[model samples]
Target: MANYERKIPILDCGHEYTRRVLHGKWKIRILLYIAEGINRPSELERHIPQATRRVLDAQLAELFKHGIIAKTIFDESVKHVEYYLTDLGNSLMPIVAMMGKWGNTHIDKLRKAINTSTALA
Candidate 1:
């Protein structure tokens, strides 16, 4: 083995900002679900049944704060709220798709390794 030198890179780029936008555990998943045409909170809940509503709401709020998604309310006999991707959020679609592609491509191997590790522990 050879010694390796690692240097800290400056967090002065869009990379850091992107990381901040997608920081939460559920954020990326939420984005994916939204991109897949599930934009409402209740729909998101049904799509991701494992996540609690509170946690999903918190992530949705963060996404809104980051200007990635926007919430709209309807004026009618029954009030309704829905979220749609902003331009900034649309910009991330390609990146997110690429990530999903990579993950799906390697998921079997990754899952096997993860399961092996978990079993060992």
Candidate 2:
């Protein structure tokens, strides 16, 4: 993980806290996918092929640390694990859904802005 410190401390605000908790690139998608029953790490990997397994594992660990998801390990001939949304994670679904809705609604404009920024960069 990259090591750095912000000159300014994070604000003691709910919005800032929420943003921090969901800060990683794939975290929101991970939460949504887990909620939709794509719980296994392998399944999640298949669903989000753009993210490396290492990054996904890091985000998953962060989510678990925040109490947003619970991990269950099954010991059989082969060991396997699955993730499920906790109560807190379930509560955040509506907000996530609304964000998705807003993005879809403004996709054209957002795409243009993103492309413009990417080109500039």
The top-ranked prediction according to TM-score is 2
Over 1-121, each residue of candidate 1 has an lDDT whose tens digit, in order, gives 9897668765878889989999988889899888788999999999889899999999999999999999999988988789999999999999998988998999999999999999999
Taken over the whole model, the C-alpha lDDT of each candidate is 0.92, 0.95
Q: Cα RMSDs of all predictions?
A: 6.5, 4.2
| Residue 28's lDDT in candidate 2 | 93
Off by over 4 Å in 1: 1-10
